[model samples]
Target chain A: MSQATLNRLADAGFSGWTTVTGRTLAAYQAAVVRIGVALTFGGFLLREWPHRRVLYGDLSPWSGDLARQMLASNHAFTVLAWSDGRWWFEGVYAAAIAVSVLMLLGWRTRATSLLFMVLVLSLQNRAVLVGDGGDNVIHLMAIYLAFTRCGQVWSLDARAARRGTRRTGDPVGVVVWAALGLALAYCQLSGFASLGMLDFGLYSWGTFFWLCWLLAGLRGLLARRAPEGEGLALLDALATLVHNAAMLVIAAEVCFIYATAGWYKIQGSLWQGGTALWYPLHLHYFEPWPGLADGLSGSSTLVTAITYGTVIAQVGFPFLVFNRRIKNVMLTLMIAEHLGIAIVLGLPFFSLAMITADAVFLPTGFLARLGQGVARGVARIAATPVVRQTIMRAPRTPERDPEAVSVIR
Target chain B: MADEPDEATSPEPIPPLAETPDLPDEERRWSLPSLLVLYLTAVAVAVAVVYHLGTVFLSIAPANPVSQRHATAINAHVLPEFEQNWQLFAPNPLQQNIAVQARVQTVDSTGHRLDSPWIDLTARDVAAIRGNPLPSHVNQNQLRRAWDYYTAWHDQQTEKSTGFGGPLSEEYLKRIGLQRIGRDWEGMAVIQIQFRSATTDVTGPSWTGAPATTSPSYRQLPWWPANDDDYRGLGVS
Candidate 1:
């Protein structure tokens, strides 16, 4: 490259860094997406816990060999496939459930998010034909989350960071280092769980994040010990730039999905004529409550309006996203629409997954305020003697940190 | 209105988001290496994003010109992890309750051949879902996908006017019937499987003073020879 070209490229890269670092300030929105996805999975795991074997066990309606064939077709992997033995499947299943709970709690999020992806992909892949739009959304969202600092708020990791203890780094670093060491060692000892993935790149997710956390702890210590904390503008710039761009891409991805779906619907005679929802309403598979669907389907005008309104809201959504007022209105409309789909179509998981993705588009301030209001309400309710006796009767343990009581909504 | 307190009359307006966020205890000056890190992160993210967007575009309309241009590449890279189709109930809503049913070929008391009782799988699924607060997701998928998989064969095979109800459909229905019946369910000598759909025409509503007798109309398929592939990979048999 010429000298001038080199200088220009360098300058542009620097400028890009500056622009992104400044703009991608808040991690709050990312945190909401993480929590929402995590919570949805938490519910799913809980609901499916007793029937986990039925879903993915050797004796599932979808047989194990068939599942393996399906997974192989999709280039997906699960520890269950490594060994035909029942113990391996059970161990792997337990690990997935544990990772899900951790994701929900937002502890060690950087590691858990990737594991969450693995679990979603593996389980969904295991029963590919039995999956839906919601499962696919979750699959994609889990992958997207690994690029984000989703545990920056409303998470146990965030609470730890929030503590920001002024005590000498020795104790904190030692404790954190010990915890990480134990976790890595535990992973090594958990041979059966990691058996299928031992030879693969999936095992690195734990080691990679552990190293990161360890390095961060050491960095925190050194920064406090010395006056200057690395003072690396490049690192900060890079972090900010990645966060901003990734978030923008995720948002755009969602918008594209909606626009494309809407576009497809628009081409259909049913959608254009506003009788699209009528068939689904009458379908036995979608009818959770047949009476409710039948009662609602009785009205022609309402059905047509809903059908047309759905198409309009979805088609015009990409344009609305740039304008806060329109976006807010659209978000409400979309959430309501998804809720209807959930109830009328017997697709709670799909609706919830879509709604979780939509929550990211909502302003962080709005969500935070809502969280705060809920927190306050809970506090008020807890103050009552009867409520306190019933709920707060359990013996309390000392908090990890006094300042860690933000209780991110 | 004039007597309203000053605080009530004029509250402070919130600042626009373009202004720097007033985050608590988050202030830190930008350093050069930090900036470099930010740039590098952006670069990495940008590459991944391009790939993600590419796959998403391909998945949306795989037959479109742009998608077809890169079809070979997409099949290799994107089709594995990101292969998706959004056509749930699209183009037109599925205007029918496609109840997959089966009838076992049996011997009558009069030494004559006969098709046994019709077992409605769709009805079983509906019954399973009705009272349960947390219905198994498979209940929603099992019969539907079976029917869809059966129907998809036609679109892939020769042109068919009606959905999966032609000459070669028996093998497909037998596979689905075997899936439902499995090795258990009394292990009866089930010979064949067929399907019926109760189609509803919403374009013409009962409320419009049309024939109130527009109840669920059942269109049953002819029984296929109970194929052995139904028992092939199920592992139960």
Candidate 2:
């Protein structure tokens, strides 16, 4: 290429990188996804608490030995397989719930996100057969959520950042960090990290965790030493770049899920005949409400339309995402389908999880409006005399400026 | 930046971080050396993004020679941790209802032989899921998928183990059956076990005149010896 062409390419690349590194993209959407995933998984854990032993604990049909053999062949990693004791299983399950709540509230999101990913992988991989489609969605999203700066908005971390209160001297934050460091070090020094599970060299959890810890430490040091220097600026830019890339990856992943499902259905003779949706309604396992399933399938036209619509909507999803209006329409349709699945099919968690995944495609303007509407609604409720007296024991504080806290960077 | 893998539907471009209203005061223009470093970093990130997405696409797309040629690399990228199949009721929705039944042979203290009736384990799962608005995942999927896994690893015609997972699946199915039976066979030592599945076709709406078969075809397997290993960890050994 000529000198002028080279110069143009360099300039274009520089500006593109600048946009990605300068500010986090889809900040509101990412925060919502973080909340949705955390809530869904947390709710799932609590609901299954009574059957924890049968589902994932030592009392389960899938013993630790069986899980180990399976994991060895598949190269999966899970801390639950480290021991077969009842106490060990209970402890890990409880920690998973705790971290999930922390992630939902977006407290110390960078650390909590990693813990959330690990726990989700641990429990889900332990009883691989006990999960459905929802578990798979959470499994992949949890890992991707770690790479995102999802707490940039609508989070306690963001609130602290806006208030100019650094967490450097916070005792709770310090203890959490130290504890994680010690645990990770022990795993490394011992042979736990060398169990050959997920032995993808650089792509392994051992490398990922150690890298995150070191980077966080370096970020803290740089912030204190040269808060405004180019070194910190560069680090911030790189983090922004990663956050943007992760967000894009998430969107692509959702698209792939729908596209593959739709295309595969096209090859089926049942789907081609446009009567595919009727069979599941008649099955004993899927028919939670026999009357409802029967009533819905009674109409030949409705069943055919839905079966065809589902295939069309899912197949066109990836391409339609480029258009704003069509994308929103498809998003609404998909959410409605999930709601129907929850009520009629009795797969509430699976429906909730699919809805959460669809939330990433929601428009930013709508989310901002939602947040404001919620704030106003809460204020109105609190203003009522009976509720106000019951909830408030002191004078209410003044509201802070919204712009200050709403900044994405 | 059209080639950037960003959401194209953003109504407006956001301002750069340095220029945002709430950002701390800092230098906007970069030095030539810093600019060079930033340019190289951008190139590297773009390359990584492409490579990662390529592998993900290969994993999700229908299997072919491209995915096969790169099978080892793709498996390393997607197995166990990131493995996904979104073929939700695809290629064909299930058109049959399969009921798995198991029976046990137990010996009394005097060595008297007795055979228990075949118990419909799948019906038990269906009962648990019937009226409950929120059925547990264990009730909804464990046995159903275990049977599916077992069949996937074993041949239906000859009923022979097909792969390493065949025996594993048998152990899994046996444990589930034993757990359900509980202490019903208390003092008698169960010596043998066998499984059979009745498959009934799900006919379409009556208007379609799809020929319905009222009788379910049965596939029964030979008796499998109940060793200590099958009962291990199930609290029955």
Candidate 3:
């Protein structure tokens, strides 16, 4: 290559590196994802609290030993497999709920995000036979969400950042890190639960956790020692690169879900005949609102329209992502379709999960306005005399951080 | 929102360099070696992204020679953790309601071998889900997916093990039956349990005037001995 061409390429590469290191992409969208996912999984857990024992506790038919065997053979990870006792199960279950709430409120999200991933995986893997499509989406997104700087906006961390409060010596964070470090040591030394750490096998989630823990510790040390040094900047740049890459993967994963679902439907004769949706409506198990389902399915044209619309949306979604207006229109349609599914099919969790995954691709302006509107509503509620006299206090509107808002393409 | 047009519409659409944030003066004036490192890292990221997406695509796409040829590699990448199936309602959505009923043979104190009446496990699950807006995952998928798992691992006609997952699924279903059944009859020790699934095809919409096949077909499994672990888990003994 000519000297000029090579120099141009090098300049472009350096610019790209700067962009990756300078700012997180789609901060509002990531916050929406954090809130939506945490709500869906956490809400599902609370909803199923009454049946917790039969679902995942010691009373579960799929015994702990059985789950452990399956998990080991499948190369999956879960702390629930650490013991066969009911107390262990209860501890993990309760911790999962607490972690979910923490992550939802975006408190110490850098750590809570990782814990959120672990708890989601632990509970889901404990009773693999008991989940639906929604559980699958949560399973994947929890892992991806950990890598992104999702708490950059609309979070307690963001608020602290705006207030110029550093977490350099935060006691709670230090305690959590120390506690987890001790737990890892115990699990590793005991060798009682495998924990995937000992195997160091390819595809072992244990390996992933160890690497995450080590990297987090290194980053923490670097920040404490030399916050403004080149080492910290380099680490931050690498993290940003991973974050951007993970966000892209998340978006592509959503498209793949829709594309595959849509393409598969096209090959099905039932979908081709435009009566595929008619069956689920009549199934007794799926008919949460039988009267509503009956009324909707009574019209052949409605059935055909829905079936075709669903297929067309799914198949065309990946291709239309390049067109902003069309993609937004289709995104609305998809969200509405999920709402319809939630009501008609009695799969609220599944629908919520899908909607949350779709939120990652939501237009930034809409999400920003949504955040503002919510803030205004909360401030209004807190200002009421009845609430103010009691314990509720009005919150000052958070100052928008320019760094958080700036989009780096 | 003038920059609204800059939203990510495609997978990795890079905007104009003018929008790129300028680094600090010190970092901007990097050594040649640092510049080389940046170029290499950027190239590495691009390659990694392409390879990861390709694997994901192959994982989700329909069965083809390319995917089949790399099934082992794909399985390693996607199985257990990332394994996914997007056939939401494809090939055909379920049009049949399959109710799994379990009957147990027990020996009373009088030494008489009597068979208990069939208890519809699926009806119980369906009942739990019917009026509830947020049915538990156990109610929605436990018994249903258990049956699907069992059937997938066993042949329909011969009711024979077809794969390695057959026996595990059998134990899983049996344990579910044992737990759900409990110990109804006092002083009776349950010896064996059997499951019979009655599947009825859903009637077509009234507008279509499609013929209804309401008659149910039965798939009965051979009797399975209720072992000590099953009884012990439920404190049945």
Candidate 4:
């Protein structure tokens, strides 16, 4: 290309930045903030709850014991020892749970986010033997949320009267933009990890999940741009383009998951009759009611229906999301499906985390209302002088600017 | 410089619209150094938490000591028995079947391995030689159930075959008793044996002869003379 042509192209690109458009940007921000808060709440609840016992029963103790053996083996991956069933490990687990709960409560929100991420990641990394994909996804999301100003809008810290009004500036916008980018990267990486390499075959559903997440991120990044106006900033345009691209990626990913999984299941005879469901339900480690298997032996029709329903849902989930009513119906079905698996198949924690992710499909307005209620409650608590004094007394470095804190408000 | 337009004609730069404006100080943007520190701190904290949890999990012993100990003891005892009756690869693909015979000796609180008059038992499998089925033991019960299934299935298959010996002879039935009769069998050991075959097929390039198509055929017989020396060598004499 000639220098003149290149200069022309650059000039055109520069000029494209000045044109602003519709309510798309604000829509994006509202979606991202709502989703972020919901995830924060869900993840915190899981961490704080005695999830091990809920999921694994008394056998949960085995996780710690296994850790000890791995340590004594002096294996190269000795970090596995960290999960060894010991009092110290329990203490660490408890502390992590505590921090996550604190995060949800919006008390020292940033500090808790950091602590929760560290604790959860540490526990997860130490024991590959005990982990599922849900654990890894939650861990990664926690890390991303930690770096982002996730607590800025919905948190108790933001509601504090003494903290003054929320500060507005270029840096805050830049950080928000960066966070949006990070969120996109995180979801895409997770999708690639599960579908591309791991061949989880959940790609069909995962694609939709990713697109939703990407759109949500883009919305946040472009929030400052005026809705339905001219002279859009370069950043706003870039944000919109990225957001749209993410939606496409999400759709493609979901399609891949459904098609691949559907085909795989078609090859199995047990899936046709729902015998496949029985396998997980019968597994001694996970079975909630072993006696139920004997009673269900005559229910061939029920079994077949469940099998057919599962396959249809798996394959049809992506396309269904295009229609709002159908999407809501399918989402409800998926949630119920997960709930059944958790209780009947003995995978409660996994089910809970998955349900949390599916919460993205919920209306942003509903989430925003929930956030508003939480903020009001926080404001009431912050009115006390004792609470204010306690917060002020917390150890902080001089570099931790009061101004920077105010921007989050 | 001399021919420049007048100050008023030069025109002032357009001021940006009044909106959420940028902070005056650029230092407000999170510094790269600070971000790096935060990232490192997060990782360090995670590592510490993992390390602390691992130590706690490893120290506990398996939940069922009696059964676990029994399993370990059986492994030790059966390892020798396996070596004695089973041949290493031999005869161009070892195919050997040897029967094992033994009596149960229960250990009392006094530490003596003595035959208990109260117990009457039947032979099961090699793993069961260290102890009989315990009603309270889930693993032991499962193993017993599996042994029963195998025995019944094997008998049915043998009976259906045209060339098999008539249902196991009365003499053999007398030697290995029928269905275990009483609770006295609980801690008593029984002897059992398994028959396995290993075969290898080797082929070389066709020889340049009158008939290049001809292939060699080889088969090793099943029966081999018992060697007392082999049993001693196995540390099971």
True contacts kept of each: 0.28, 0.43, 0.42, 0.00
Candidate DockQ scores, in order? 0.19, 0.33, 0.32, 0.02
Tens digits of per-residue lDDT for model 1 on A1-409? 9999999999997555456664444466787778778777767767777766656665455666555555554556455664566676677677777887888777766556766777776677766666778878887788778666676556666455545322344353455456656654564566643423433353344455555555445444444454244432233334445667677767877887788788888889989877777778866677778788878878889888998998898789889988998899999999998988878777887888899889878886787777678769988988754455456663354533323233321
Off by over 4 Å in 1: A1-16, A22-26, A165-237, A386-409, B1-41, B104-116, B131-134, B154-203, B207-237
In order, the B-chain TM-scores come to: 0.59, 0.80, 0.84, 0.15
Candidate 2, residue B70: how far the Cα is off, in Å: 1.8
The order of the candidates by lDDT, greatest first, is: 2, 3, 1, 4
lDDT of 1 by residue, B1-237 (tens): 000011111123223233222121135554676546544665667887787677677768627887778777777666556666666566666765566666666434464566657777778888877745456665887557756755655543333424423322344345546666663334345555555655544434545574533566665655555545556654546
Candidate topping DockQ: 2
Please give, for residues B1-237, the per-residue lDDT of candidate 3 as tens digits: 000001111123222122222124234455566556656776777787777778778988988999999988888777777778888988688889999999999888788998999899999988888878877777778999999989999998999999767877888899889988875445587889999999999987677788989789999999999867666555444
Better of 1 and 4 by TM-score: 1
TM-score of each candidate structure, all chains considered together: 0.76, 0.90, 0.90, 0.40
Q: Which stretch of 10 consecutive residues in model 2 chain B shows the poorest summed lDDT?
A: B1-10
**CAPRI band of model 1?**
incorrect
Tell me the tens digit of each residue's lDDT in model 2 across A241-316. Answer: 7888889989988998899999999999989898999988888888889899999998999999999999999899
lDDT of 2 at B111: 89
The candidate that wins on lDDT is 2
Q: Report the lDDT of model 4 for residue A221.
A: 35
> Candidate 4: DockQ?
0.02
What Cα-based lDDT does every candidate model obtain?
A: 0.63, 0.80, 0.78, 0.38
Model 4, position A170: C-alpha lDDT score? 30
Candidate order by TM-score, highest to lowest?
A: 3, 2, 1, 4
Candidate 4 lDDT over A1-409, as tens digits, reads 9999999998875443222111122222223432443454345445434443312212232233333443233221222233233454556656665665556555433345545555554555444334443453465345444433333334444344134333322344345445634643664465522212212234232353344345433443333344222212322333333333333332333334344445456556656645554444433334345455435433656655766777787668767777888878887898898787656544555566556545545555555566567768888777544454356553365545565456446
